[model samples]
Target: MWIKKFTIRGILVGLVCVFFLSPVCMAELPITSSFGWRVHPITGAWKFHSGLDLGYDYGTPIPAMFDGVVVQAGDFGDGYGNQVMLYHPAMDCYTRYAHMSGVIVDVGASVAQGEIIGYVGATGNATGPHLHLEWIVKGEDGGYVYADPIGLWM
Candidate 1:
């Protein structure tokens, strides 16, 4: 009887561990394609700009990084143009896609990883067409802190 009770308690503990760890293990963003280019006519410099720049003439599709709720979506007016901000509870992180031509998701909407959320564009303070992608960690005072999106992938 003692051995059986010990085994049952171990099993329960294992199950609880799985439940809590699953979400952290499951956050990721898919890369469709990436390209490095010389700064456009707007910004004349061949600085080492990293990150995959998905190019489309118009009406290109952009996807979400992970399964999360849209905490904010609108024209932020900070050179981001029409942007979408997603909060991933599982990852305990947030993603910001900026300079978008259009936004497909709404605030409070649940989106799966790699799901279409917006299209690329030159808006806000952008000189050319591109998405200023950023990964953010939760900060104190209900604010978000920025992280290098390229570094996150690396």
Candidate 2:
């Protein structure tokens, strides 16, 4: 029912907090790496970095940035390690948290903003403990596009 109301207008205004994260959690964390093109930390070649890496202590709790359904959870062996992908219909977008120590939410579960979905870890290709966050929206061609998530989360 909620997906039926989707529109480009929704995506434009979606950053307005249809749901809110815990006030004290993310604002204090430092950004270890930003999104976009850069030299790979693990690899020697240049590649596009799809998400923002938030530096944190190992096993730190990770919260959902918006109210959404957990469309995916667990390690898919795709190099993301233990991850959680949430679909936020209100924003006409999805948010992904990767390289997690553990995933607490399961696929299809509805999560509120600020819900602790997982814990931080140096999983997958990561060199150290951090939370890799991605903001993805649909493109005009109806394909998924990884947008810079810093504007929405911070």
lDDT, model 2, position 86: 96
| Candidate 1 lDDT, 24-133, residue by residue in tens | 22133323323234454345766333233434445566677677899989896655688898898986877777778899999999998778898888777566666666
Superposed model 2: Cα runs more than 4 Å off: 1-29
Full-model lDDT, candidate 1 = 0.59
Which ranges of candidate 1 are over 4 A from the true structure?
A: 1-57, 139-143
TM-score of each: 0.61, 0.80
**Candidate 1: 10-residue stretch with minimal lDDT:** 1-10
RMSD (CA, Å), candidate 2 to true, equals 6.1
Q: For each predicted model, how many residue pairs clash, with residues at least 3 apart or on different chains?
A: 2, 0
Which prediction has the highest TM-score against the true structure?
Answer: 2
